[model samples]
Target chain A: MIEIKGLVVRYKTVEFKFDDYKFKKNMISIISGRNGTGKTTLLKSLSSLIEYEGNIKVNGEITYNSQEPILFNRSTYENIVYPLRIRNLDLNLYKEKIDKYTRVLSIDHLLNENALKLSSGEKMKVSIIRSIIFNPDIVLLDEPTTHLDLESIVELTTLIKELKNELTFIIVSHNSSFVEELKDEEYRLGGNHVYS
Target chain B: MIIESTMKAVELLFSFDSEIYTIIFLSLAISLLATATASFFGTILGILISISDFKLKRFTKKIVFTFMGIPPVVMGLVVLLLITGPFDGMNLLFTKSAMYIAQTLLVLPIIVGNIIISSEKTQKKILETATTLGANKYHKITLLIKEIKPFILMSVILGFSRALSEVGAVMLVGGNIKNDTRVMTTYIALNNSMGEYSMSIAMGIILLLIAFVLHTLLARFRGDFYD
Candidate 1:
């Protein structure tokens, strides 16, 4: 479970004060706003990548996947297994999961290719797989669908929906269809969140 | 006259002369050693400078970047003073060790400066990514180094290039002693001064070839990684 109280992010002179929100575990929530509204800033703040004034109560470890993910100068396999490798986790434990997810995302062929050469959409897919493979507690994805095509986006939406039972997600995206399809709740940065 | 000398230079290149080969081999060994040593320390220092936040950061960077342009003669003088002064009884002047010391100093700044600049550009993003992925301090540093290895290799190559062309420092500290400390650059200078144009040209050609081969190797390394 993750709860935010009086979350405020200030960059230079512009300030963003997000409404208080409580996001439950084993669910997908969406944070949406227009440009300059600090949507990504909120995600970064949650990840502790930037400084902010707020209380973010999270139950477990977290992973933040950037909108434009940084792929190392290595193969996609290396990039995908990075989060696990760094945690000193047994990569063999996740081999089956990696294969399953790569097939779902249709990036199985790209696993051995140089990651830097992948198309933008392919890179985003790689980033998504890398992020979720380690099965962190809270995953914050900032505009992850920006480079993804419609079919890829649908595939991702399904993947997130399927994984939401095990991993909590706070996604910042403007893809209305994706948000409508995957979100169990929605939080507007400058406004309030609606929980059905 | 120039063409005649070039012809003679070509002839001498394949002559299998022991002296020429000896000087070539000595230069390659010493420069490789100096570059390797400088790279090891320079890259560590560079990574430290990039990751550390201190009050004197700006000032320290200014000084280091300034040293990147330090003249070989100036470095030679500094090493000369160090050896001839406080360590007078060391009898270190005009030896291969002195030349090695001088060349290391000459190449250190180049390696450090290049690494510092490249690391500064990539460290923040790489570290941020690693942190988000739950890496500890040791893991973050290791990942950063692994990711920026190409840039580190480039710094090493730059250091080697600087060491390969070095003449002033080696000439001063090495005394260009034949069969002892004579290297390609110093050997060329010595031969050129003695009207041995063919020998100088032969060394020059070999020097250029080494540079080309190293650059091609770097290109291949970078290409393999960058798609």
Candidate 2:
């Protein structure tokens, strides 16, 4: 569970004041807002990526997946296991998880290739796998479906559904279909305020 | 006349002069040592500048960039004054250590500036990624350092090149003493002033060769930094 109050993010002349609310655990919450609204900023603030004034109480570890997702200048296999490597987890133990994820995403053949060379959609898939392979408690995804294709989107939705029981997901996306299919509830940002 | 100098220079090279070899070795040693020290500090400072924000950050960056353009002669004079002024009691003037100090100053700005420029675009993005991956302080630094390794290596090479080719400051602080503080650049300057064109040309050839070898060796370690 994540709770926030009096959350404010200021950039130059712009400001985003969020409502006090509790984001439930073990659920998919989609933050939806118009272009100028602070949907991404709110998500980033939750991930602690942005400086905010309010208090945030989180129940477990969180991982953020950026919209475009910058991969390290390394092979796809290496990029997938980065979080694990950082946590000092043994690579051999996660071999099956890696294989399963790559196979499900149809990226098994490109594992040895440089991740930066992959197409945008493939890169997005790689980023998705990397963010969740280590099993963090909460995953914050910013516009995750932007570069994904229809088929990839379905695969990702299924992947998230399978993992929904184990973790909470806070996502910001303009893709209505993807959000409609996966979102348990929508938190709409009305310009600088919360409407939901 | 050029062809005559070239031929004589070639012959002098095969003559295996110990004096010439000593100058070459000393030149390499001084530049390598200076580059190493300057790069160590420059990289740390570069990372700090890229990652941290303070009131004086813009001013500090301006100072670093300004120092990058300091002329070799001016640097040499400043180093000379430093040793002979407040540090006079230490008696470090006209020593190899003095030359090292001068060369380190000469290259420090270049290394820092290059790193600051090269890592500027990627630093924030990479740091953000590391943060999301649950990196601790040590992990973040190590990840950032790894990402910037190629640029750091490039800075080191550039610093070494500047140090190796500089004559004014090294001569000023080293005193260009024969068999003691003499380096290739100073030796070339001294020997050229004495009208010994053959050895000067030989020294130039050796200097060019050293640069070529250094580039070839270090270029292999740059990884995919170009991409």
- Provide DockQ values for all models, in the order shown: 0.76, 0.76
Question: Best-fitting candidate, measured by DockQ?
Answer: 2
Query: Any residue pairs clashing in model 2, and if so which?
Result: none
For candidate 2, give the DockQ: 0.76
**Model 2 lDDT tens row, B1-227:** 77898899999999998988898899999999999999999999888887788999888889999999898989999999999999998898999999999999999999988888878878888889889989887888878888778888888998999999999999889999999999998888987999888889999999999889878856765655665
Q: What C-alpha lDDT, on a 0 to 100 scale, does residue A115 get in candidate 1?
A: 89
Error of 2 at B73 (Å): 1.9
TM-score of each: 0.95, 0.92
In order, candidate lDDTs are 0.87, 0.89
Docking class of 1: medium
Worst 10 residues of 1 chain A by lDDT: A187-196
Q: Considering only chain A, what is the TM-score of each predicted structure?
A: 0.93, 0.95
A7: Cα error in model 1, Å: 2.9
lDDT (10s digit) by residue, model 2, range A1-196 = 9998898887455788987878899999998888868887787888888898979998899999999888887899999998998889999999998998888888999999998889999999999899999999999999888998899888888889988999899999888889989989778787564333
